[model samples]
Target chain A: MGGLTVNTKLLRQILVGFVRDEVYKVGVRKGVLGLSGGIDSALVAYIAAEALGPENVHAYCMPYRTSNPESEAHARLVAESLGIKFKVIEITPMIDAYFTLTPDADNMRRGNKMARERMTILYDHSAAVGGLVLGTSNKTELLLGYGTLHGDMASALNPIGDIYKSQVWALSEAMGVPSEVIEKKPSADLWAGQTDEQELGFTYREADELLYRMVDQRMSREELVAAGFDAAFIDNVARKVQGSHFKRRLPIIAKVSNRTIDRDFRYARDWGK
Target chain B: MDFTVALAQIKPKLGCLDDNMALAEAAIEKGIAAGADLVVFPELALTGYFLKDLVPEVALRLDSPQMEKLKKLSERISIAIGFVEVSADYRFFNSAVYLEAGEIRHVHRKVYLPTYGLFDEQRYMARGERFRAFDTRFGRIGMLICEDMWHLSAPYILAMDGAMTLICLSSSPGRGVTESEGLGSAAAWQKLTTTTAMFLNCRVFYCNRVGYEDGINFWGGSEAISPSGEMTDRGAILEEDFVLAKVDGGALRRERIFSPMMRDENLAITVKELKRIDREKDC
Candidate 1:
């Protein structure tokens, strides 16, 4: 089966062009991206470097106490290999300080804080360096509602988002990312020993295959199951995709006018060129 | 020169900037395979339209490093796409970026901010103040957002600025309307497109988004019109696909010669003055 092969070279060029064009047009030169040490961030860093050059790409590793040390090392390794500037800021003390102040914070709330903390750091650096935060999440993560809003999901521009986990591996390999980074078990490193498959209860290969069939192909449950996917797995994935749909869209505004932005306010980017 | 353009009708996940760019790349590849010299995508194609609060967070500055990828993609074919452009002062506007020959040729921000109904654009997007046409290899082309087509001044400004072709990118919702409504709506939309083509004595290209996101379904009715006020080519509505059409730039000159609409100063002057008065009133 010839699945949609994301052209990594093309993808990198496109990302680089996106950043460089925006920078050249608007006159901003630097950029920042959260370095999670996962395949997503690894790929994003490489693309940003290609787009803005290593001198311009700033990779920040915001690790909490709960975050695995291995992931931090991996993030550093990727940043160093690419010759991009890197920084490691531990979020444990800050997260602890916030929790100390708001003791009622639950896991979900704390997770959100962690995500937001990373964003604050990225944006602050962005201001100081005149850069935009590049996003690192993938389509699978976005569809699964796997990321915290305004946290890991935040970015001024994302280059690898369309690539599924499986496809990210393909592109990472093409971009010469180390096998260790590409082949490692996927995790957000949000907590110690927190593998993405373990927490989500599905492997990237399985999830991406299912998602490719469902989203890219728009196959129904019966069709997917008939193709030999487990019925429960299909339902679970579908439910996740459905549940997290809101995160994938703009806030619905009630239409009450002659020309709505998403409706009638249509114009080409180079309409008057 | 005859310009063959493709309007890519795609479904983009909001906030999924990378994926949206990938989709755009795929669309361009398709367009190139079909021999298109330029490809146009829906407004905010990179970041996805309808990003409410996320617009500020995800909005890209016009000169952000993210657009380098698109610029490289333009090495072979010209591309135009829309995104949330944040300025130096942190004000955000809905803007389009034009890429050709490995460079960003121009950036046009949407001027009209629709606040009512399903649009809180005014809440998040700052209105654009400038309107002008740019010179391209194809010809002098004009750009506008979806709602900009409704205003008489947008096309007028482009024409006054000496545009020979007008292109509009849109993400118009279907709004639970029926087929009959769509037919009527299409007629109305076609009238607007044709009117602009006729008024400017220039060809027009309009592309719309197609797909259901939340409750708002984007009805894709991408089309291309000749200067003679004829729908030369149109894309499918409410579907994910692209429309390819060959437009003869020479046809504009020929059509203008045949129709003499460009020389009709009586009504054109009044319309231009009325638009100027309205713009002055707003100021």
Candidate 2:
């Protein structure tokens, strides 16, 4: 039902301006991103380079010992092509030190730990280089709560958060990202032989259309089914989108006063005057 | 004379008067550079909408220094903008002003203070009673603030009072989505503006702001409609635009002669009917 496509040239200009303005408003022109060599990170890196010049953009390839080598190479390729600084930081030692204590740690725990650790590394690099952390999470992953909270989702600012995964692929191709990075199977690389589609049970194209109709179009489950979507599929996507709602917002503060921080004192992102 | 209006759909920071005025002045300069005869801003463009308790703090008197700066800008071109008006009685009104040649030409206080839904305007601001049109160098123009135009009678009264150009400043949030129409609010507003133009035989300028403020987002689909029920030009949706469009007085005259809706309207009969209904309602 959703056949939406973005004009890459126009989108590039808009996003580049968004990045520049949002960054400049905060009195900073430098940006740092945790590059996983996936389409999302690759796209963000390219845009950041375009917005803040290649000299001001920095990319870090934080991989675990068991992480795929292809991912690290792809991340390097992105940095090299954009003429931005690239660094490789292995999270194997840091992750294993904690996991060694908990012998029964599951794959989820390990993945979450890795995600948070990578964020820690990115933030540290951001401070060292005087750059803000650029978010790479797309709208589909953000809505579905696919990324770990406060881990992969943590950022000073996000340029592609409103874009869907399917749209991200299209934008990536249009932005001239490497063909290998665009064609590769999407993955979090939490463990060996792990892939995103296998874990989610549906391809991004299918889920993206479902999300576009449900969220953007505001179609109900019944309406979606009547429009020819599988009832169960629609229900599943709805549940995921609903369940992940908390990840999209700030932590709720108990409001005992008239001007509670996030409650009554909520202001625009650039309220510092 | 054919007048060109610069419909500036901009987002102003809430409770930040200095910044908002600076932005307004910049837009005015840009519009002047674009050869516009008049420039229009969104409702409460100076103080921002949803002020709540901050209304009185940010409210400006007609002689306030901020308004003096705005008046100085109007020395170059006609300026139409919205702000909270602090009266001599110390009451505030959600108001729009038409400033020209370093003077306050006209002001229209918002008659309808929408209290229900997301708006709490009635809680903080007093309602205005009069709807008047005033003469400018370009033409006789009327100003309505946001919800005032939502009520049909506001524009109708202005049209009857000899306003040939209707300027509406709105801070309306985007809501509702149907398959046929992308944004329901935008579609509804388009119909309202175009119908008002066709029925009143006047040019309509609808200026809406864009940006997120306190959770509610103002969708900017500002447009200029001709007297012939045609959308002459429109601004970008959810983006800032400083665009100018020509309004032909000749076309307006031709449309008035062709349709003659205003000429055919029997105001005395309608007033008599309304008065009789009021009297007979006791039965």
Candidate 3:
């Protein structure tokens, strides 16, 4: 189902170079990131270690008590494999402490709360190490809006944000990530049985091919259906893309003044002046 | 006369005019030290590409001190460069310039402002209007800034105007890593330049920038193509590289005499057909 193949060798070079240059440009040669042990985080950990030397890469594995133990093991595996700086901070106490006040929290709320807690820890660790927070969200989750805003989505830079999840496996393999980590079922590990596919209602392979055609190729809905995509699947995917539009952009600022912050007063994140 | 030209595949500091100028000065000095006749820089070489709202901030008037400083360097060896140009009317243009003997030889404002897909050039800057070749100490040559050369008419117009050398200054971004070959955008550019060189019977020296800006990356595969469509030299892809290639007048003359495509060009018929197409567009 995943026909989108990239030149792994060249892609690795470009991504590694991107991380190296971007991290150094922002006045730091170091990068800090939350390593979830999923393919996305494992892949980013590998790239960050390669870009800034392993010594400069600080990886945090913040897992809730409910998170599968394998998640922590694989996270440790990736960190040890890369020889990057590693830490494991159990997120249960902070998350449970907050939820103890608000006992009516559902699965979605707990998951989001844990994600944001990990984000705060990463930022705090970033300041501790004087490094930028590296983002781990891939294109699939980003486009689907499956990530928690200001939580897992927050980062100073993301080398893999543009890469699709379907492609992340291949990139992870190419970069020598442990096979077990790459081959595992895609999961957020928020709960005992939680997997991304169970929640998203579709595999990444299906979504990637569909999104490649629907977005990159700019195929119309009629054309997509005619090309053999199920109407319901197409509808579901398109809605998520549309629904998550705000997640991909800066917050909207009302134009009370002539030049708004992001509206008309736009400057690049790498602005030299 | 045969002469050496240095393709300075530079990486510009985004919106930092002084830092970029230092880069330009260093490259120019290296070119002179190498005994090259000319040094070519990429589009907006003094100010990095993707300067969305920072256009006016980095733009320089033709008579600005920065322009004068670069002009004075041309006394040793001719220079071809790209920058944001501000007109007396206060409109900014993506412009390429040729400098020789401490004087500005010619300035070509980029004609086609690409506003599609990943590019949004038309949003912030004014588009250039025409393609006109000009004379330098070397010979008659034309300048194309990135997309200007994408349209067939841009290079064709210059060749028909008696220019035998076409210099393209580019800040092309790297994309499409899935192509069977190398980068998809790079392959497209290579095909474009190789065919243009063969058809126009001219020397095509392309200098493209390297470096990353925000999330975008510029691929730097600067090249020199001979009239016979032979790739004489090419800079490293996706990295900073300074490569030198020779411009042999004898080679150009021989290729033109052998191919004779430029010799047999029927501009009158082309003009008539263009006029007819223009008239039909109004229908």
Candidate 4:
């Protein structure tokens, strides 16, 4: 309803149905996700809670010591409001333990480590709840490859992966997601003072509009430029989308067999059961 | 000549042929119970959509046991269902078959296999080359599978062949949204179906599948549109529904008299113009 205007209520029903059907296909009626207190994960929680029922939705607020306390508070607010299962898992200990061994690790490496650490915990806990780990990556981040793969990107199911961030914000508000979660500055909270816009170098508002043109509308570079996008802006967005292609796909299988995996012997993820 | 059609808007588990076959049998029983003369299922209703590399694995030859079972059921009431058709040459096609009176009536291979934007039909299935109209108890009927209806000429060719009703089977993914509508795909489909019905002066029974195949949700909303371009009956959105459309044949007859677009059609001139354009483009 923001960059891409849609009937948020209808979109919500569709996404809820997506979660409900996808989870049930695997013979589970439960969903698990990291609640980062950001809109993306909060929105997924709201959808999942509605789909599998709040009793079946398990939420973990995994925060590092340096991670914003406000994120944890907002995550609590969302879980309480939805009446879902909520737990606060401190990621600081594990992340700190890893950084202790590597001690001179850069902020980028540290951030990636925290993400992977959370992924390991989330997956391990997912087994406990017997629920699928729901992904929180929106289309904007997924296209730009902004999240760490096999980390925050590892999910058994992702309802928000197709909707853009601006759309996430809009949908979150429509779905009665706590304004405390929706109105906050978008962040991964991998490190202190980290906001998504600061790291991405562009606001989702600008990126979503540009992406709506470049990706969804399928506008060419010249057409995008003609439609009021600067060369620099287009180049940055396009490069990030192209560069992060690996994050969006399965690991490449080498073609050696007569019928190779992913190359010729491709079956849908929904193949059979 | 009023007739009842049960729009079998059922969610199929992808590539689960036996499961879907069972589901189909139950739906057929439901339709028969509802006193429906015909039961229509969405495209790829037998094996489900998004088969991809599993296309060959699930494809049913016309004489396969699966078709034999469906043909047997047709003895009670008519059935129109979508499946991957395996030809004798081993070529596979996204096909729909009409079974009536325990006989295989018509098999319509999808002409336009959409390969862009979440669809990969062309990568797996062979393209159908023709649009033909065949006789049924209901009268002359034309069947088009999904993308075939997107091409304006496909319906035109069938109309020219004297089909009174156009049965369009689709497994359309729910996508795009506007303030005015829930799904842009559904809105686009309405526009296409109604216009084709209006201009072609025929009824359109658009049967679309429901449920998720991967993340792409097929919005159900299976509907029956009159020749006057009105949605006489529509099913539920994003949910399975057994929508019963009481199609009054008088609507088509009355609409034909009023607009007469079909009556005024000149195929000779249209074909001549197309040939001229083709020859010029060839040169």
Candidate with best DockQ: 4
**Taking the candidates in order, what DockQ does each have?**
0.01, 0.10, 0.62, 0.70
Candidate topping TM-score: 3
Q: What is the interface RMSD of candidate 4, in Å?
A: 1.8
Rank all candidate structures by their DockQ, best first, as comma-separated numbers. 4, 3, 2, 1
Query: Across residues A189-270, which tens digit of lDDT does each residue of candidate 1 receive?
Result: 6667768899999897889888988987889888998999999999898899899888776577788998786665554231
Off by over 4 Å in 1: A253-273, B1-283
Candidate 2 — what's its lDDT?
Answer: 0.86
Among incorrect, acceptable, medium and high, the docking class of model 2 is incorrect
Q: Clashing residue pairs, candidate 3?
A: none
Scoring model 1 with DockQ, what do you get? 0.01
Q: Model 3 Cα displacement at B239 (Å)?
A: 0.8
Q: Using lDDT as the measure, name the better of candidate 1 and candidate 3.
A: 3
Candidate 4 stretches greater than 4 Å from native: A1-3
How many steric clashes between backbone atoms does each model show?
Answer: 56, 0, 0, 0
Q: Which 10 consecutive residues of model 1 chain A have the lowest summed lDDT?
A: A264-273
Which prediction has more favorable TM-score, 2 or 4?
4
Residue pairs in clash, model 2: none
Instruction: Give the per-residue Cα lDDT of candidate 2 at B41.
Output: 97
Candidates 3 and 4: which is better by lDDT? 3
TM-score of each prediction: 0.51, 0.82, 0.98, 0.96
